[model samples]
Target chain A: MNEREPGIDRRQLLKGSLALGMASLLTPRVLRANDSSTVTLPFERGRRPLVAFPQKRPLMVMTTRPPQLETPFHIFNEDIFTPNDAFFVRWHLANIPREIDINTFRLTIRGRVKQSLTLGLHELQTQFEQVEIAAVCQCAGNSRGFFQPRVPGGQWGNGAMGNANWKGVRLRDLLQRAGIERDAVQVRFDGLDQPVAQATPDFRKSMSLPDALQAEMLVAHSMNGEALPLLNGFPLRLVVPGWYATYWVKMLNDIEVLNQADQNFWTSQAYRLPANPCHCVDPGDALTDTVPIGKMPVRSFITSLENGGTIPGGERCTIKGIAFDQGHGIDRVLFSVDGGQQWQSARLGKDFGDFSFRPWEAQFIPKPGHTYALQSLAINRIGESQRFGARWNPSGYLRNVVESVKIHAS
Target chain B: MIPVWMFLLLLVGATGFAWGSPANGNDREQGSILNLPADPISFQPGPGNDLASRYCLMCHSAEYVYTQPPHPREHWIEIVNKMNASFGCPISDEDMTPLVDYLVTQNSLQPSPSAQHVQRDDLKETPGQSSTQSGDPQKGKTLYGRHCVTCHGPDGKGDGPIGQALVPPAANLTLLGKQSDQTILDTLRNGRPGTAMPAWKNDLNALELNHLLSFLRTLSP
Candidate 1:
């Protein structure tokens, strides 16, 4: 059996074991603000001894008011389905619903429809076909904290993502009842979330009319076979499989069908990406034309071993992790143990659909006195692979670079 | 390697990891109550500190200003104007300058140290040439005040009234120090595309452009 030395500082361990090519692999656990100057580092590590709030387990708190919480990296190693309480929380506005009355809650479907229907919470659950899907909901800014020349926005670690079994009615079913008008050009979504100041833009987003009618889209009320957590949008949240979390509106109350394209701030200005293939450009390069951030790219994370953790030398060890992509599905996952000079395929775990996280495992026998530089690369069915380096954008969206981690073998 | 029993325990004991699973979660009327945490963030004191508190603090926390990557004074002006124009903050034209001044003092952006190594040169119009003593700094300062201060800010931080109205906003002049002198000259002659900056080829003579470039160099923190 392998044993680790007790109480080795993770920072000192990283300082000792960080390889020449693995500089990007290591970061401070948390970027603490200096007391006098109040300055924080560009990137931050996860907060330990997690802070608990509401129905949530101790999560890494990014902000308290709107409640931006991040999942701890270690929890990814536990199960394929991220627990509801452990899931991350992100809110664009400050006035999030504190107390939701189930009896009075109504989901109003109006605008550009023949019949406008407002359904209560009970009717929303029992009236439609109950379906369950295991999908991943990841923020567009999942790894924004790691960005070099870091941009302005919520600086987040990899924990801003989770895979859960979502249970609800198909959005198509709800739209059918409302009878969408032929002139409808787009479908807009709004939630109970509102800004404190009237000047601040309301949190609203829209999908093209055709895209909104897709069969996979859902109005999820239950996560992981249980009622949605208060922080995770208790009453209902839209589940747009394979899309970023921004498109998945939580605490949903209004579904308006627009005859013309949406001109809202969230759609017209924010969450936009450069038209480039990787959406990357040099720092300060002008992005004149842009498009909305849509489907996510291929990504993988080695969660089984903690960064700078130690392993027993001359003994075989199993490297386990998870890989995912947009609903195109994960084609294969490759592990690189020698700074990406070579790669070998890892064994795939159970199939949980294209939108769900797919776990993988590989065996490695460490050589004594050598530091193992480990990396995982995932490719989707469309042959899209994770980039070796992270890209930059003004909004800091859709960062899907291949992840690297290192461990010492003593 | 992990023992088979431990592996089995991982799969079987998955639910145990959840600290508190609510009782009667399936009950329809037993609604979940979420109490949002109080706002614990406040702004740091700097120049025009009261203006920042009066205008900016009304909408969001001070974390927004403190967390931004350090930018030039002109950039702060654009941001302030955006707050006024886009978000409808009631800061008048007089208060705008001081608010921007405060933001510029606070923003001492340091690029990620690790990221400095891979900095790309291909993005610039002209590469490799450093600053040269072609323009007079005194003349440049005068030219900046007359032609540029309204948009690029008096300090060239891009915090001008018109700059904030632009879609992409004005470029922070302080960051231009890393560019070749020729690149800065060309950008002035041929304004950036997909932005509000316009070509100044006809607006200023070559000597005046050089003078403005020299003055911009002084704005670098």
Candidate 2:
């Protein structure tokens, strides 16, 4: 679509013909001072040449080694349930399984259970009552690039997140079948994705026993009513509704119940945030104590307007976006036109679930010669709202600040 | 000739092609490994760069070092230290200083002696003033297609087909509008000393360099 735009040259056509596998050099670009404020702005989604990966459509590619793909923002503007193919892909380890025979693959539920159970795919579908839930599974560092005092990690735009309808047996039911021991403290999950080097830490995550027993948590085998795309953990994955995707282990294979807190590298060293209410630490402040990143906070973004985009004066335009929280459910989304001074309530869309993305819309007429600061602030049921300034964290986890876009009135 | 299933198994074993599920039934998503383009970055040969190539390349490609926002010497030191302490990067204590020194020398936007005079002149060219007045976008496009299109990609998203293999990934040049022209010019001439960006001083003339800069400006919003 962008190829037809004026000023874009034949370079776009050349990119389409080039094999992505060839080696090349790229000149790095730095940010300008006038374009950005004291607070850092989110990186704009780079326009990438269309290339389809396995079981996925052409996505905005970030890194290819373990395959990191960001879903375009316009997809979010369409529906609350992000399509299975359009779902963003993130893998930590280099070795992910290529194929699994349904008959041979087994899910083992062992540690701290009275009766250890090993169930095949057919038995897993027939034996237990299949349930479905719509939930948002966002990476802990979804907007890491926006963090001030810029932390080092995956430089992600706002697309490292997606919401989907998952179908599977509840973790509570599966645990009941396994018969969890009373002294079980935590439940750990393991996936087929493994690191290449033996010395590297294995990708693993554990949750408190109470969180494990929540009815919302599911051992999902199917996404959006079909078998999961191989890139998105084909046969099985764990769905922890209203939480970050770290706990939603993909290509799930094992469930080990722990009698104590998980001391693994993934839990203890990585995916950690400050234990404070704001969940932020001062820049360069040595963290004294940290807890594992859990529920994502209330956040929202304007999708209709691009940063620095132009609109005609006196034109009535309807501004739209998506907002979600850590399962308390979004109470209301407020649109701020005159900076943060005045905010009007945007009309809310259908409720999918507490864990689903809630769409919101508002209409306004642009004023001539005025640059409107379009911002959306999402408030959850508990009255927790997004902050203007993003809280700083070392690993760049849980950035839920109000997102603002700048548009010119001409 | 091998049977279909056997051939599939052979293919999986031959290449570590164990990524997507086998196409069963009407599933269009069946495939083996995703052959993403290889990373285009390679450290320029030097004493410290050789050290980086030896140790750092084991876990990550040079893209990790190049994609970083140019940081201070202390920041590079902290990063190298953290890699050793936290991620268990194996580097002898003797080698740490040289690696850090190489990174600072390469990544720091601070001008080298040869580019010092050019940088001074560039700094004086304020935002409103066009330092690249003689630059030709048409000439710049030809030069870019020949030299840079592989890694930076056609539109400067750094999604060049080969650039996908990089650890840190390629730098998105589309965002350069926010930076001063001097910074971009310096990077072109110096080639980020330690990283994959090679110095273009030997490759292009001053006028040609200015033209390349002009072409890059068109990529920005």
Candidate 3:
């Protein structure tokens, strides 16, 4: 079991050294006010710098204070399980915990329970039946940059999502230990992060008691078989499988079982989607009804060949990518080399789990000097496929539009 | 060869030391600490730029404002009011107009070309001569120290304290001596798309930009 540690450590070290060498070589000696190195996304004002944070390789920087770092799209093609260092990081509040004492850290279960209990890291690890599952944790605004007519939040590209094998004790076991009362209605989670102002609502989220008791819900202390990074919530965090990352509260320290519904700002006001079947509304239309953003919709991506990339002409080339949905599992991935006109089945790769990124590949022979529009459509077991065009909304959430990449055969 | 039990004992010892033992009574050894890098970008100079720095930076960084898509005046007003009303930003009624005005000036979409030209004409009294004369590099250096040094670094190596944390990082200006003045001037006027670089069209006039460009030339080897 421990044999893989040396291999993973060596590989990471080599990658880190190579990346540093390339950065030094490509960096110019002279700098100007307007001359910062940048990678431009395929949208207006999409130029972003690549910065490295602790325990992470160079990733796209969206904000500096709360540190919303996005993984590069190329990392998706590397492996089915995203390396813990390469996983994306997002925090809502600025004053996040920079230090955590594992020995002193405690997971408190209180409110509406038969008994309040606080479990230390060692107790939580040893007393419960340890379980492991591979799941995809994605931000609700993963592809907000692609939204036409634009939106006003973090303008991220398609790099704000990642899949990983999470290891932890089940939340159900912890709730059972605390003994839920008959009046329990909801389970609210609070993290170590705090708002700058007292009046500003603290970052908190809740789910129905039934939803929280799902067997898949975990109070994870380890990610990808290692202690969670401080930025990704070190001591402990909640892992809500198949749900948006917003509900997977990082640096989780408190779990309060409430007798009534949660009316916090993050619950009632923020992260709301239009309450429609499509979760969409006409652009510029006022939202009459809204609901808290939940389960991620079906999505897919072509990770191997990027837009405007060149492929070998008059030869067979293997096109590869990843496909995933909010659990039901990807039924079949349809590949179109002619921009959705012709559809061909791509062979699906090994299954990690229902809540994991399933790899898929297809073969294509391109004619020399021909430009082809490549697209992938992921259909789940429930027959939910990606929309041909992007859905519009004021907040720009849940954009699972059929992604098209225009590439030329060399 | 070491016995298997002996090896296991050594492994347990190492693990305990690495994570810290409660018996040691050293709190510092038990927890891990991380020091995040500083931020370099700030709001562009305008009527209420100071107010924005005072109030907004209390909760988030300036990139939150700089990164937004160019919105209309109404959008800026709505966001500001939301921060005050919902997020509890402490802007008073008197400071509201100036704060919104500053935001609109820096981040709002540009007017039509004809109207823009008219505004430009109004700002510059001697627009014709401003382009003809070269600027003083010494004067440019002072301006660079004030604005460019934050992200570009004092030596123009893009190693500024805050620039270290930026994605794609701040540009290394020392290698740009070979580039033409027009290219640099154009970038200064229009700004690079999707980058933290903001256009100096409203902040700096043509002559001041030329001075900044002259100072930038000195960064090249």
Which one is best on TM-score? 3
Candidates ranked by DockQ, best first? 3, 1, 2
lDDT per residue as tens, model 2, A1-410:
12122543323322322222111111111111223211222442222223245555556555544566678777887777887777888887655664566668889998999999898878889999999998999998797877777777766678889989999999888898999998999999998776533455779899999999999999998887778887788789999999999899988889999998989999888888888888888998988888888988888888877788898889898998899999999999999987788999999988999989998899999988889999999999999999888889888888888877899898
lDDT of 3: 0.75
* Candidate 1 segments whose C-alpha is farther than 4 A from its true place: A1-49, B1-24, B28-33, B65-81, B104-221
lDDT of 3 at A51: 59
**Predicted structure 2: lDDT:** 0.71
Model 3: how large is the Cα RMSD against the reference? 13.6
Q: Evaluated with DockQ, which candidate comes out highest?
A: 3
lDDT of 1 by residue, A231-310 (tens): 78878999999999999999899999999989998998878899888787787788888998898888999989977789
Clashes of each: 11, 10, 18
Off by over 4 Å in 3: A1-37, B1-30, B108-221
Docking class of 3: incorrect
Question: Global lDDT of each model?
Answer: 0.72, 0.71, 0.75
- Cα lDDT for residue B142, candidate 2: 94
Give the higher-DockQ candidate: 1 or 3.
Answer: 3
Question: Model 2: which docking level applies?
Answer: incorrect
Worst 10-residue lDDT window for candidate 1 chain B reads: B113-122
Q: Write the per-residue lDDT of candidate 3 for residues A38-77, one digit (tens) a residue.
A: 4568886565666555555556777766778888888999
**Per-residue accuracy of model 1 over B2-113 as CA lDDT, tens digit each:** 5543333333222222223555366632263342333233444346765675566444545456546575665577678777876666688788888888788776543222
Model 2, residue A405: distance off in Å is: 0.8
